[model samples]
Target chain A: METLKIVKIGGNIIEDETSLNAFLKLFSNLEGKKILVHGGGKRATSVALKLGIESQMVNGRRVTDAKTLEVITMVYGGLVNKNVVAKLQALNVNAIGLTGADVNSISSEKRPIKEVDFGFVGDVKKVAHESIDKLIQADFIPVFCAITHDGNGQLLNTNADTITSQVAIGMSKLYKTSVYYCFELNGVLENIQDKNSVIKHIDSKTYKYLLDRGIIADGMLPKLENCFDALKNGVNTINMGNTDMLIKANDNFTKITL
Target chain B: METLKIVKIGGNIIEDETSLNAFLKLFSNLEGKKILVHGGGKRATSVALKLGIESQMVNGRRVTDAKTLEVITMVYGGLVNKNVVAKLQALNVNAIGLTGADVNSISSEKRPIKEVDFGFVGDVKKVAHESIDKLIQADFIPVFCAITHDGNGQLLNTNADTITSQVAIGMSKLYKTSVYYCFELNGVLENIQDKNSVIKHIDSKTYKYLLDRGIIADGMLPKLENCFDALKNGVNTINMGNTDMLIKANDNFTKITL
Candidate 1:
């Protein structure tokens, strides 16, 4: 199987112009097949406020009502995705922007109302691996926004981290896929306030020890769990870091393994 | 050569919920390989107003300043394009949404500054016909919005009619292509007020007479000119009508020719 790199970027880099340009320049230089997954940040909230749509959240997760979904569809799928693609094109990389709805690339089921009604949020149920593989084989880079469709004319807001994991797992059938969760942090830090306390590696034993020590809790727990899920599946390797780790061999990141 | 249908739709149908759905249904049912080109209407203007971006128009064409371009990218490329593609998917059509930046499908040069610095607008320079052909051959429907890229990290506002013509001309190399300009009007009306005054056929001679008599003036003039240009450049046929013309054989439209 050929090697493929799948990178997921969150709000921190996306909202900053300088960081986005610098990161995109390095991403454009990555060799072989690559996929980019992006998360919408405060832009959606600000745009919603401007449009007079009030955003609702439960447990730090957005409740994607119809209006909020429309805002995200416009911001994440449109502004952010196209901007990244255009920049990549400037560097001679053939990039295609996509949502789950395009070419039925990914399909999801609306999250059922269990305790909290998350409105139009979806849990990914399927990935069109064959279709995406064809795109990669044709030398086109796929830039995905965190919006999906139900295959029934409904677009749903989804989690970018989960999307990255699912897509990496799907493509693992034909390629040795490595998934990177790229954000502002250098890596998983032992001391939350210290950027230098990056955890270099976390095997299952180390993961258990970190959890027992109560160092890795809350949001970081879910993210690490998602990475572990991908690793346990078919994804070859998983890394969490800033953009520089992808370009240079730096230990300022967290590498996950069984 | 295989037959290809390229349809361009304006704002009338897009702004209306019921009408847009009906048109998308008809579009999905159309036989053979097809491409859809869409225009963003008052939605961009309204959204701009909300975002505090002032729109400038010169000779009825938008003066796309940097701010205006961002709004349109959000509206046209994001909101409208995704909605259309998702609807088509519900009808079981394999639909993919595209901007010129995606897959480098289309490339343009920023319109050089003359009297008006129409900020970030672009003139169509090249179309990646081969990449599009591969997509069509793989049984995917390409839905395009009126946003293009300069191949240099900039997304430019473009005329939807010109995008339609350029794409039709580009695809004419490998397929027998027809371009349909679908909008509010049934066809070219002999009398502007009478809905039943549609002219059934128009050749170069008839078109000249219409212009000479001040009949095909203003907006219709540029549309007809684009049609003629496409016909002269190997496009097999061109039609102007409502959505119904695409579904059934109806004489309530005008056919253009040399």
Candidate 2:
């Protein structure tokens, strides 16, 4: 099977122009078919603030009310995603920016109201792998933002990390997919203060041990969950590290294995 | 050759959700291959105003400074374009949203600094007909906003009318192309005040008569230029009318002939 790389960047990297461009330059150099997924929470919040829209976050998840949804649509789907695609095009990469609604590429149902009404938040129901495959086969690198539709005219906010893993899992049916989660940290470090004390390899048993000892919690918790989920669902290789890991062999980056 | 319909909507329709939705429903019912080209100037100006960015217009054209370019990217590329795509998808049109940078489908050069320096504005250079054709042949409708990119990485503000004519002319190389310019008016009116004064046919002689009489001056001047240009090119048919003209046989609309 052919190899495919799916690299995901967080809002922190997207917020910094220098870092984002630097990461994109490296991404443009990666060989073979690839995909870029991005988030724009920081920019969305800033734009919303300027528009006098207060952002309410419940337990680290954004409460995507009606107005917040519009902010993200403009920020994530428009400003950030298009800028990334344009920069990539300049780097000689044929990048096509998209949301779930484009070609019905991704579909999600509104999150059911249980503990909290997430308003227009979407939990992904399907990823149109065949449609995406057509674009990839046509040599077009897709750049996706964290926006999805209900296939019923509703736009919804979604988690970018979830989108990354879901795309990896979906594409694995056609190619051997390797997923990368690039963030601000070196890796999942043994100590938060020590960047060099990276847990280079993380297996199922090691992941449990680290979690029980409070070493892996909070935001990292959901991230690792996505990594493992991708691995279990046909995505072969999953890595978590800083943006630099995509360039060179970095022993400091954490690799997830079964 | 198969027929292709390129529908261009002015910003006024997009500003009102009810009218926009009504128009979209009519557009969705259009037979065979079609493309939707849109302008979001009103919403962009409003958003820019809220952001305290004073819009500069010289001869009815927006002076797209760096900040204004970002504003258009969000309003046109993000909010308006995606909403339209989602709505079209709900109508089962299988729409895909794109800009010039996406797949390198369109390319333009920055307008030169003449008497009035139009900052970051693009003048059409080339349209990637094959790239756009691939999407249409795959049964995906393309919904475009007034944005294009320089090959070097800069995104520029483009006029939607120009984009519509240019795309129609480009696509005519492979298909029988028909372009519809749907504005607020019923059609190009013989008398500005009378609603029933719609000009049914506008050939070169009649158009020259109207121009000499000062009836077809200002904004309508450039619009008619686009229609005639498209007709002169490989495009076979061109019409100017309200959105309702697409739905049925509207004798009130104007049809351009060579």
Best candidate per TM-score, number? 1
Candidate 2, residue A122: the lDDT equals 96
Q: Pick the candidate with the highest DockQ.
A: 2
Q: For each prediction, how big is the interface RMSD?
A: 0.7, 0.6
Docking class of 2: high
Candidate 2 colliding pairs: none
lDDT of 2 at B94: 93
User: Can you write out model 1's per-residue Cα lDDT over A110-147, one digit (the tens) per residue?
Assistant: 99998899999989999999999878878889999999
**lDDT of candidate 2 at residue A41, scale 0 to 100:** 52
What overall lDDT, based on C-alpha atoms, would model 2 receive against the true structure? 0.90
TM-score, per-candidate, Cα-based: 0.95, 0.94
Report the C-alpha lDDT of model 2 over B1-258, residue by residue, as the tens digit.
999999999988998989999999999999999999999858888889988899999888769999999999999999999999999999998999988888887889999998889999999899998989988877889999999999888999998988998899899999999889998788888888898799999988998888898989888898788778778888888888899899776567988876
